[model samples]
Target: MRVGCPKEIKNHEYRVGLTPGAVREYVAHGHEVLIESAAGAGIGADDSAYIAAGARIVGSAKEIFEKSDMVVKVKEPQPQEWAQLREGQILYTYLHLAPDPEQTNGLLASGVTAIAYETVTDDRGGLPLLAPMSEVAGRLAIQAGATALQKANGGRGILLGGVPGAIPAKVAIIGGGVVGLHAAKMAVGLGADVTIIDRSLPRLRQLDDIFNGRVHTRYSTIGDLEEEVFAADLVIGAVLIPGAAAPKLVSREMLSGMKKGAVIVDVAIDQGGCFETSHATTHSEPTYEVDGIIHYCVANMPGAVPITSAHALNNATLQHGLALADRGLRAIAEDKHLRNGLNVHKGRITNHAVADALGHEVHAPENLLYVA
Candidate 1:
């Protein structure tokens, strides 16, 4: 099998799909790797490094898309890249298709077999492939929110960790999953007043034990969410619904009730956002004011630290990627967890969550592959 990796072209996105080490692993598996020129530049790997790893350096992304049996990428294909996708070719990447109708339509029109990393599951019912980036984004949310809280950034001019005799900023995290847990860790470490709201009582109890009373774990309710969010100096939207769009927990009316100059870092912006006012921003311009509340909704928050993001992402995805390269659709047919990652295959939506979210026709991956 020939696997191709093209340079990521999203705004300020520098992470590549495969590292030289990952390429070497593919070579060891008897797979030919084609990396587009400068594909690994984000992670500081050069063409010479890929060559040493037994990967051929292709001149352009066009050649890679045209020739490779499977295309590996860090982010979803942009308009031009999706245009190059051919029928029967495999695309393994993060396809947040629920919120992006344009991208969904493009993939369907291209007739490509698209496996989304975000929807991939593990036996523990955890999103293994999305965990690494979620961890990065979760930690980064605190940093970004802190910066946005500065007076110059249209925030309330309060320090996250207040000095003696000063009150610390209140941080409300709207989920208790991987992103929320890490965000809580960062906020608590900085001496902020942290409260995590979730509907899962058992998970809340687990978090309460983990924090040992340092962090407040609240049962999420409409009233509780309103109170916590309104009182918070910084609110981190970390809620997720797998392949579906994130629920809008903070509405526009609710934002108006929040403290003036409050900051909201929607870590769930990639799956649409938990804040009603949230819109995807780039690192160059990460925050905007909505109803006097600052919103830092960078869709690719992990991309801000490409070195860590790329290596972490590659570590989580390499094994599944190798499986696909070695056996193609047969890998998905055999692994139920990997099959959950199939969002689109041969012009049909394969994931139920994604299909329901986007109102698209659903097709079972096994049916499409004729696996039986």
Candidate 2:
């Protein structure tokens, strides 16, 4: 099997699909690995490092896309990269297809077998591949929200953890999942008053136990959400719906009711955001004002810390990627969790959530793969 990794070309995205260590694993499995020149530069691995790991360094991304049987990447293929995809080629990456119609349509048109890391599941019904980046994004949300709350950034001139005489800033997180939990940890660690709201009572109880009653847990409701949003200095939108678009919990009308200069960090922006006003921003200009509310909606927040993000992502994805390299579609047919990762295979949408989200016809993985 031939596996290829091209440099990530998204705005300010630096995480590569495979690390040198990951490449070494593939090579050891009798698979030939090809990496674009300096593909691992974001993670501080040079061409020489990949060469030492038994991966051949290709001169250009074109060469990699043209020659490899499977194209492994960190982010979704850009227009040019998708254009280069051909029938029967496998694209293993985080394709947040529910949000981006253009990319989804392109993949369908290309006839490529697209496996999305974000949709991949574990035996525990958890998104294993998406967890590492979610953890990073959740922690970074607090840091980014704190910065966005500064007066110079057009936010209320309030510190997250106030001084002896001042009141601490209030933080309201709108989910109790992986991202919300990590955000709560960061916010609470800074002595900020934190509240997490979720619909799942069991999850809320778990959070209460984990936080040891330090952070407030609330049952999510329209009235409760409004009250929390209107009162908080910072609101973190951390809701998710697996492979579907994030439910818009905060509407434009609600923003006007929020405190003037308040900050909102939509950690769910990758899945089309839980806040209605969020448009994907880059690290260079991470925040924008909407109805007097500041929004931090960087789609690739983990990319801001590529070194840790790359290693963590590779650790989670390497095994599944290796399975695909070793046995192609058969690996997905054999593993139900891996089969869930199949968003588009051979021009059909195979993931129900994604198909419904995008208003496309859904094809069962079993039917598509001709599994008995």
Q: What C-alpha RMSD separates each model from the true structure?
A: 0.9, 1.0
The lDDT for every candidate, in the order shown, is: 0.95, 0.95
Q: Which parts of model 1 are misplaced by more than 4 Å? A: none
Summarize candidate 2's per-residue lDDT along 1-372 as a digit string, tens digits: 999999999999989999999999999999999999999998899999999999999999999999999999999899999999988889999999998999999999999999999999998999999999999999999999999999998999999999899999999999999999999999999989999999999999999999999999999999999999999999999998999999999999999899999999999998999998999999889999988999999999999999999999999999999999999888999999989999998899999899999899999999888634
Give Cα distance to truth, residue 264, candidate 2, Å. 0.6
| C-alpha TM-score for every candidate | 0.99, 0.99
Clashes of 2: 0
* Candidate 2 residue pairs in clash (backbone atoms < 3 Å): none
**Residue 365 of model 1, lDDT score:** 86
